[model samples]
Target: MNYQTISITLLILCLPQSEANDEAIRLGLKQVELSKDLNGWKPVTQSKQIRYGEWTTNAPIGQVGTGGGWGNWGTSVVWEDYKTVTSNEFERASLNNGENGLRIQSIEPFVPSNATKYYQEELGSFIISPRIDLSTTTQDSLFFQYKSNTKMNLEIWISKDQDSYWGIWEENPNRFRNHISATVAENDFTQIKINLHDLLIEMGQIFCDNERHDAVINPETNEVYIAFVAYDNAERRLGSDPKMIEIKSIWTSSYYSDGQLQPAPIDPVISFDHKCSSVTISGRVGETYELQTSSDLDDWKTSYSFTLETYFETYPISDFQNTTMRTMFFRLKHKP
Candidate 1:
C-alpha cells in the first residue's frame, strides 16, 4: 500500500510568529537613540547650513516662499527631492529628551508676523537611515521598536540597487507603511516584527497596480537603505497638540516560519487508518493550514483551508478519491 505524505507551506499573518532563540542583526544607526546621539543618521533638510543646533524657525534664503519654502519655519524638509546629510561638514539635527530616545516633534508654523502668504509649513522631520546591506540575505525579517503621537503619520521609503541618495530607489518610489499604528498607543512605544518578503508583497499590491512583484532582496541587489519619514501633515493643525515620533532600534533576522528557522523544513506526520478509510495528519496544534490536491503533481488545486483546534486532523480519503484517476497526491500548507 502506497501512502502519500502531507506537504506544508507558510502563509503571511498580520502578526509575526516568534521562533525561540533566533538572533537578529541590528540595522540602522546601531543604537544611536539609546546612546542619545543621532550618530550617522540625520533628518532630511534643504539648507546644508543649519546642521547642528537647537530646532529653530530659521528658514534659509531661497527656501521660504514657494520652491522648498515654509518661511524657514519648522523642518525645511519635503517629500519631493528629500536629501540626507552626514559628516562634520553638515550640521547635526537635534531631537528632544535624551532619556526618551530620538524624538522628532512637530512645531507651529514660523509665520513671520509680516509674511503675506503662509505656505503650510512642514512641522516634522523625515529621518533617513544609513546605507543598509541586504545583499548578504536571501530572505530576511525586520524588528523595530518605536512610538509616536496618535495623529502622527509615519511613512517609509526604500532605496535599492545602489541608489545615490536615501529617498531614491531603482524603480517604483511608492511608500510603504505597516499597520502597526493600531497597536501603538499615544506616546507609548510598541515593538513589531515583519517578514520582508511579506512586506514586499503588501507593497506590490498597493503600489504596482495590484500586480505581484519580485522580491527586493535577491542576489542581484547591490545596495539598500530604509528611510523612516515622520511627516503627518494632519499633525500640523493649529491649536492641536504637537505630534511627535521616536525610534529606539531597528534590526533584521534571517527568514523563519512558525517559531522555527525555515528551509530546515519540518515535515508533518501522516498515517493511514484503514479501519476508518481515512488519513491523519499530525502537526503543531493551533496553526492554520491550507490543504491542496494534485493529479499529475504539476497542477495543484486548493481542496480545503482551515485552522487546527487539536494536534491532529483526520479526513476520509474518499473525500479526495477520484474514480478515473489511479494516483492522487495531497499536501498541507501552513502560513505563519
Candidate 2:
C-alpha cells in the first residue's frame, strides 16, 4: 500500500465524470432469516387466545366520515401472495432471504382522485411477537427487509407492552414509532439494521375516535409489540391504484457499529445495476477504487474511478458497447 497524504476533497472535484462510474457497496449488512423452529417467536393468530385487541386507522383526510377505516391484525389472515411473472410498469418486490414474510395489502378499487380535497387511506396492522425473553440479552438494533409499489406508503411501530392492546397518548414509554411510510426508500429489497442505542426517537400524532393515538420513543429496553402500518393521506390526486406493503424477517440482534454508512475508514463493495438505458454502480463510503471494463477480463482497459467522498450511494454507469458487438465485463479493484 502506498502511504501519502491526499486531499479527498480536491481529488473529487478534479476527477472527470465518466459514463461508466464505480462505487463502494457496504458490507456486514445481514438480513435475518426465519426457520421452522418458530425462530423463538409465537406466530399470533386472529383468535381469542391472543391478547391483540380492536384495530383502527389513522385520522381522516378531508371532511369527517370521509376516510376512516379500521385494520385488523391476525397471524392466520395476512401475507399476500407476491409473484414475478409477466409484469409491466409496476415496481416489484420479493423476500429478502427466503419465502417467509408478512404482507399487508388492500385492494381498494375505488380511490377517488380529487386534488382540492386531501385523501387518506386506512392503514395499520398491530402484531404482537411471541414472548421474547430479552430479559437476558441487550439489543443493539432491529433489522428487517421491506419492499412495495403501493404509492410509497408504509410504516411500522414497536410497543413496549408484551400483550397486544390499545393505548392513548398518555402511554409514553409504551410505543416507539421507528419507521414510517414516507421515510422508507422505495427500493426492491432494502435491508434496515437500526442501532437501538444510537437510534433516534421518532413520533407522530394520529387519532382513535376522540382519543389521540400518538407515538412515543423510549430509551430503556422493554418487551414489546411490533405494528406494521400503511396509513398516509395523498398530498395530491395520486394515481388511483391498490395500496400495499410486504415486511419480512423482523428480528432484533446486536449490530456491528462499523462506520460503513458514515464517512470513515470503510471497505468498498460494488453493485452493478441496469437502470434506464445505462448501468448504475453503487458502493459504500471510503477508499479510492478503479473500475475497468474489457471485452476479455484479462486486458482490462476502459475505466472511470473515484473515491466515495460523501455518502452518495449511486452513480450512473454508462458508455459501454452494445453486448451484441462485444460483451464487456466490469470490475472494481481498490488501488493503493
Candidate 3:
C-alpha cells in the first residue's frame, strides 16, 4: 500500500473512543486488538500464593528483654521478651503447629506505689517485627491460633521509625504506622485471620491526603515503609485477670484480594472491534461473555454470546452486520 492508505487505516483504528484503541499499536497487520475490559469477572485458575513469604519463618523483630521503659516507652531496637517487657503479664508458649506463639495473662491491678491520681492504667507488652514491605501487596492478613482466659485486646501497628510507637499513634503523621485494634473474648483455641485492608481504609480516612476524595494512595509513601508491631493492651480491673489470651503460629501473608485468599473467581477481559460494516465482540479464553448494545446508554439489548475454548484460541467475535447508526455503545457480562 502507499502512504495515503496507511494514513486512512491509522485513522480508522484510532477513531473510536474505545479504551483499547488508545494504547495499542498495529504492526504489519491491522490495529492491535483492544485490551480486556476492567468491569467483567474472570476465573481464578489457582489459589492465591504468597508471591513473597515475609513471615514464613520464626523471625521476630526485636531481641527479647531489650525493650525499655513503662508501657513500652523505650527505644527497643530488638523485640522485647514478654518476661522482660510486660511487667510480668506476658509469656512465650509453644504452639502445636511447631511454631512459637505469645501468651498473655491477667495480672492484679497495680495502682502504683503512690496509688494517687496517677494509677497504673494498664499493663502491656510490645514487640517489633522485622521490616515488612507492603508495597507490592493489595492484601495483608494475620493468621494465628489463640485461647483466651478472659477478654483480651491487642493492636497491630506499623511504624516508619522503629522507636516511635507512641509518636505514630499521637498523629505525628511522619512516624506512626496506623494501628488496628482486635479483641478475643473466648477461651477456646480458635483460629483467626485478620485482614488489614479494612483497618487501612480507616487510616486513610483519617491520615490520607488530609481526606481528599480525589486523592491517590501512594503506597511508596504510605505502605512501602514500616515495621510490624504486636502488643498487648490489657485493661486492669480489681480482680485478677480472667480473660487471658495465648497465641501460637503467628505470621502475616499478602495476597491480591479477599477472593485470592482461597479458591477465587477472577474476571476476564472484554473488548470489541469495528469492521467494515459490522461490530465484533471478543474476550479471553476459558470464559464466556454476553454482548449487549445500546443507543441511549440507559437501555441496552442483548446481541449475542461467545466463549473462548482456549486462552490462545482465535475465538470468533459476535458480529452485527445489519445496523445503521452514527454511534453505538457495548457492554459485556461475564458468565462463570
Candidate 4:
C-alpha cells in the first residue's frame, strides 16, 4: 500500500459570554483566600477600648411585624470606633476558619406604630453604614446561627456606591432561616458560603421583588457596601430588650484581582496529519472534530474524527497514489 501525507490546521472561536461567566464563577470559588479556622476568630467585643453595647443614636432602622409582636424584623446597625481593627470590622470579623461560627443572641428592638410620629430614641436603633469596595477581589462567606425553637428573619444588603444609596440583596422575610446545623450542640457554628456575585444576585432579587433585575460589573471603582440584619422572635424582658445577639465570626476569601467574572483558558489547538492512506490527528481529550478529503481541493468530502472511543477509523482507500491523482488533497475541518 502506498501512503501520501497531508496536514491540516483547525481554529476554534471564543466561548459564549454566558459560558465564560459560569467558568469564572467556578474558578472564583476555587481561588478563595483565607479559609481560617473558627477557633481563631475572636469576638469584636474583645477589643478592650471599644466598649460593648455602645449603640449609635442616629443609625438607620427598619422594622417588620410578624403577628402580635415584633418577633420577625429587619434593621441596619452602625457604630463608630477609633480603632483601626474595627474600622472595616464586619469584613475583618468575617475572616475565620470555616469551622468557627457566629450566632444571634438577641435582636435590637424597634416598635412600629401605624402613626408616623418621630421617635427620636428609636431613630437610630439599627444602622449599617458599610463601605463596599468594588475594587476588592475578595469572595466572602458568612454563617449566622439561629435557634430552631424561634422563627428567624434575616436580611442582607449591598451598595455598589455608598450606604446612602444602599439596597437589599438577600432576605428571609418570615421563613425560618436554613443553616448547616451541627451535631456537636446548640449554639455551635453553622456555615453558609456567600459569594460576591451571589450577594449581587440576592440584592437584585430584593430590588426586583416584582420584576427582572440586573447586576452591575465595573472594576475601576469601589462602589458596594454590605449589611447583615436579623430579628429575634423570642419575648422581651421588663428591664431590657433581649441581650443583643453576638456574631461569633465572619470569614472572607480574596478572589481574582479584577473582582469580575473571567473566562477559562483557551483549549489547546487541534491539528491533523494525513499520510494519504493513513492520518494522525492530535487534539485535547474532550475536543471534537471532523476530517475531510478533497479531489479538486475546492470541494471537500467528510471523514471520521476523534470520538469517545480511543481512536477514530477511516474507510480504507484503494491505490493511494492513483487516488491522489484525482483527489489531490485532504483537510480536517472542525464541526460546529
lDDT winner: 1
Evaluated with TM-score, which candidate comes out highest?
1
TM-score (C-alpha, index-matched) for candidate 4: 0.30
lDDT of 3 at 11: 41
Q: What is the C-alpha RMSD of each candidate to the true structure, in Å?
A: 21.9, 27.9, 28.7, 25.5
lDDT of 1: 0.46
Off by over 4 Å in 4: 1-130, 136-152, 164-186, 198-221, 232-244, 253-336
Could you give candidate 2's per-residue lDDT for residues 137-234 as a string of tens digits?
33435556567563545444455454334332111123343431112433365555444433422321222222222222233333344444443222
lDDT of 3 at 154: 45
- Computed on alpha carbons, the lDDT of every model, listed in order, comes to 0.46, 0.40, 0.38, 0.35
- Screening candidate 2 with a backbone cut-off below 3 angstroms (N, C-alpha, C), the clashing residue pairs are 19-318, 24-283, 24-284, 25-269, 25-283, 25-284, 154-181
* lDDT pick, better of 3 and 4: 3
Off by over 4 Å in 3: 1-86, 95-99, 108-120, 149-151, 163-187, 197-202, 209-243, 253-336
Reference-based TM-score of each model: 0.39, 0.33, 0.33, 0.30
The residue pairs found clashing in candidate 1 are: 7-332, 9-333, 11-335, 51-91, 51-92, 52-91, 52-92, 59-72
Q: How high is the lDDT of residue 74 in model 2?
A: 27
Per-residue lDDT over 78-176 for candidate 4, one digit per residue giving the tens place of the 0 to 100 score: 432231111112222231233222344443333233212221211111224233333335433333332223333445544443324343323423321
Which digits, one per residue and each the tens of the lDDT, describe model 1 over residues 145-183? 567655555555664432532332211124334422223
